[model samples]
Target: MSQSTESTTESNPFTRPGFIVAAAMVVALVAVGIVIFLLPKGQSSAEPAPASSSTVTASPSASSDGGKSICGLPGSAETTLGTAPQSKWELVGRIATPTDPKTFGPGESDSSGFRTCFAHSPTGALYAAMNIVALGSSGSTDLEQKLADKLLVPGAGRDAAMRQAAADSRTTGSSTPIQVRGFLIKSYTPGEANIDLAFETDKGALGRTTLSMRWMDGDWKVKPADDGTTYMGATQIRDLSGLILWSGV
Candidate 1:
């Protein structure tokens, strides 16, 4: 499951046009299916799943309080925006994931095989979004189901994801790995956040997607789209011009 992030001038599989298309498709399906699996029957490459009501307005108490506990985890008072935040990269379930112990979490884990406990700050939300995508696309069916059960908000979207996981039996394909290259925080409140994430393929193809996060129970969980996928508004990008570039790769 370990692969190099280096670029090569020689003929390589990642540089091929076919691999780029597959990689783009894999990015689109990050929260719905494994990166190496094909789209569900009848889902078209040109047609995206309907967008979900993932955006939420900030509440009156949305401001950051460094001394207060937002979700039973340590709180961060930092409210700075429009800059790349700090992160450390480590392999989580076979995919490179970002982590910040002081802020963002998976600060705690249990026998259920799910990572939890993240800070309730903007940076924390950013890290949570990245980790969720990485873990969901880690190519493990059981892990995917566990994430859907534990880290996704309880809703029709979660129910659909649970059903899809139970029914998933597709063989892995030759899709290349997708990496998080940059991000933008579309909006945030203490209770909810809408984050835009930038993804890149090994061949340098770029795409963007949005994730809605809600502070639930004592941790941050992804709020899936109405269709049961973890992300929405996925589209190919020409470059990383407008993003605050950040990556663990």
Candidate 2:
């Protein structure tokens, strides 16, 4: 539910890409900011149950035209374009893993990029998605988004209504696309989605992490994460929001 953008030109407090620094930041936030909760096992009950990739289901309630839901939910794909709701969901917590800023290619200005998606999932529920598009070197933003759209909402790309809207949003233009690299589909049922992503800038490797999320209020939301309950939602911080200048001896 919480979608934040880590731009090449802004100072995002919740965004970074070093395993150690990210871990520290996440620990500090959860310990001080999050209220924390103990949720029932309705969606996230039996851990995570992954379904076959061949089948597509309809959402329980969808407004999309076709008979299939986006991401193969249960009903037709809903009209979640710009109308996707953003309120009500709480920013419970977040985490990130930073890495040595690595160059995307030789003589490429040594870019520095970081990846950190906010967390927002109920204690024990899972938000499910059928497909996922990891960040990669795809030059086309439209292609990137389409890859994500189809994964996020199945059948969306196949339907007429969803197709036109997405087209409109693109021809209009955008600021910059988050250089998401790896996309992995976690679950086919509701309340289950895991994102394995990395952020690479013109400088080098920023960070990487596997994020877990759930579907809430008809939208996919991220959840607090951790290698385990004891180290859940941990981040590894390499530096703060500002640039880190290295001075050669």
Q: Would you list the clashing residue pairs of candidate 1?
A: none
lDDT of 2 by residue, 86-119 (tens): 1122111111111111210011111222121221
User: All models: lDDT?
Assistant: 0.60, 0.26
Off by over 4 Å in 2: 1-10, 15-178, 225-249
Instruction: Give candidate 1 regions above 4 Å deviation.
Output: 1-72, 78-80, 110-113, 170-174
Candidate 1 lDDT: 0.60
CA RMSD of all predictions: 10.9, 18.0
- Model number with the top lDDT: 1
For residue 127, give model 1's deviation from the true position in Å.
0.9
- lDDT string, candidate 1, 1-249, tens digits: 112222220122222221011223434333222244333465444532232323222222333533343335565544445667556788765456877665467676567445667777777788787777766554556666787788889988888777866666432322455787777788877778888887776566567778888876766788876657676666666556556777777
